[model samples]
Target chain A: MSNIFPEVANKVPRWILFGLTLKVLAIIAGLYYYFTPSYTRAGYQPVQPVSFDHSLHVKQVGLDCRYCHTFVDRSEHSTVPSSNTCMNCHSVVKADSDKLALVRESYQTGESIEWVKIHDTPDYVYFNHAVHVNRGVSCVHCHGQVDEMEEVYHAKSFTMNFCLDCHRNPEEFIRPVDKVYDLQWEPEDPEWEEQAQAFVHDWKVMPPESCSGCHR
Target chain B: MNRIITVVYIFLIILVVSVLGFRGSKSRKEPLYLFPDMDRQARYEPQGENPFFEDKMDDRLPPQNTIARGNALDRAGVFSSGFDATELTDVAFNTGRDEAGEFLKELPIEVNHELMELGRERYDIFCAVCHDETGDGNGAVKNFAPPTLSSANLLTQLYIDQSEGEIYNTISYGKNTMMGYADKLSPKERWAVVLYVRALQRAANATADDIPEAKRGELGL
Candidate 1:
């Protein structure tokens, strides 16, 4: 039998082929960026075991970030506070609330309540809380205004490029070492930027952009 | 040529459709790790259970008297006569109450400039959030127009009448909505905070006579 529609095969219009190729390229480019880890993980707010409201504790109650993250400035990892920290106030404040049963049980039994990690960095990337915090990076810079968050979520894409953006220009985000914990602090005046520059100068802050900076 | 074009077009369409149909975008699933190097390690995590230990806990307790590095002074026995009911004079640990269970009227630790400085620093970190920087109790926490320090709150005549030891007790075992700092602060630091609170009260309530002789001129007292 004759080849079905033989003329259509060899003499197909070049413009249609070009148009199809362009569409395929567009689809690939769109999906590639859309499905990137940064885009996919930007707002991954997992449902926590407890409905802990950061807004209630941090914003309304005006608790400092360090109140719960007790080791941010001293240790490599910023650990989640123990149940005892919650019981410190809950034992008296909301002593009988059913919502805090898990906290009470954990505190009493000396068992830990498993808090879901929000800002999870990959194992290959070594992130140190003390280094960043002690060097004048405020908690809000990377974590967003957690005080305003009703339920805490990962605020930034903790990707390599995201980290390198700040690591490359340390001065723009730097503040006075004392003001590092002031999550709400802003550049009050031109002098504030000047002060940050001075701090960067005085402390000799060099956020390394090398592979070993985080990879090690 | 036509068959080849059709095959290429179909392949591209299939790739695009499959990628687009991946899953619910809002689902909280992590992306698949194509090269998940060290993403999940075998190392023990903090507070994670371990069969190796008798208690099955990864966090091991220090072997009995392992005094934390900075807490060495906590065990120096600064108090000569505390809750033991002894009549010693040099004791700084008063347990913050009298026999009647009322707050003590005297501070066990001596109030000095160094102690006040330490107190100021610790207070700023721990108490300022709720108690505010000036200890007016108007800390941003309550958001309900908390009473100023000199008013009828914790710094007034009723509270001031209590001994410094009583204040220390209040710090150790928090009263009302305030959390106890026994875990967060050392005992000496608590006493220093008490002294600092007193100083804050004095500063807030100072009259012409309370000001120092030299600084009085600057204040136009």
Candidate 2:
């Protein structure tokens, strides 16, 4: 301790040392929030290539999400539709539009629309499209009432606890596959629906809820 | 110079003591391990309170480390799931049949004309590559040829020696050279393909006389 400074020989008062330590900590606290990223909405919402509307396709056109995003029930990704999927109607249906031009160019060049992904789990979270889809999760459960959205927002704040709550008690939040994807869907009668949801949700599926559930 | 020497001596002493202590701990100087009676090894420290609520382990741990006992360890939970072969068999046999068992009663399955069309598409992708489009055994696999899954011989044997669920079980988990559809087909698709397979078998056996003329092309004689 004496080696640190010549002043170390002096008997520093405990109060003076504690007060200086607190002042240093306060300055550090002031700088901390300044550097931290904004915690609102998972801190990432990069712009997508095209302004796509979920409500127009899902609610109005009555297109099931699985139509365009074909592999959701069978694979890892609820894959972005290929340009051809868009062009299936776009090429002939909207022949004059810029969206059609972009589609035509992608069809010719074989590059896809550069869509920035909005929904993302952390790298550690191991989610499967198959388990959720086949086991009665509707697409709307995580994706929100995407069919009703004008511009898709982060459907809900999909946090670890948010997912585990349903996973732990699957039937409560689980419903017919048709209604799974709705964020805005409240059960018609809160008490009756809550009881019904509880019946299935109470099945007590013991999911791996620790670090490895998502991490590995 | 003296201070530096003193500091270095203290560091060396710490390094030596730590190494010796680690080695001593590893050696287990108590030789009573061979005789369980002479040892305190049998004494069970409570494996800690609330074992269930604690974080689970890799599941690959040895018997000693495993907390699982009795009901929890009976079978892989996957086996109990609707997707598993055994569970699927039970559901297949119980549901989807009426009195005479002529055809499916009402299985809790969703039907999309698009998805069945998708079933037709994926059946072409996966099933046809083996079962052949005509439901015959002449698929284009280089050397291996699987049995005709669409044959009346296999399909018509109601209770088929093996239960219907057992057949579904076989399709899912696979048998002989057939790869299990567990990886390839979703549970719904697997069930759909089973229905589609039945349709193919019925078609394979159906003659022109059996069809009501109007729906013949759709049956594709």
TM-score of each: 0.72, 0.42
Candidate 2 wrong stretches, greater than 4 Å: A1-45, A169-171, A181-185, A189-204, B1-221
Quick one: best lDDT, which candidate?
1
Residues A1-216, model 2: lDDT tens digits? 356756644544654575567556755754442222112232333445676777766554445566566677777667677676665445334446774677778767765565655565544457888767766667767766667766655545465667877867676666655454444556676575666555455644445667776667
lDDT of 1 by residue, A1-216 (tens): 978877756646675777678777867876776656556666667777788998888656767777778778878878688887887656555678888999998888876677766676677778888999999998988898787878776667666777888888888898877778778888878677777778788998999899998888
For TM-score, the strongest prediction is: 1
Per model, the share of native interface contacts recovered reads 0.28, 0.00
Which tens-of-lDDT digit does each residue in B19-55 have in candidate 2? Answer: 5332112121212122233223222222112234332
lDDT digits (tens) for residues B20-82 of candidate 1: 553223335554554577876766765565789786778787779786553444433654443
Interface RMSD of each: 4.6, 24.2
Worst 10 residues of 2 chain A by lDDT: A33-42
Error of 1 at A119 (Å): 1.0
lDDT of 1 at A154: 64
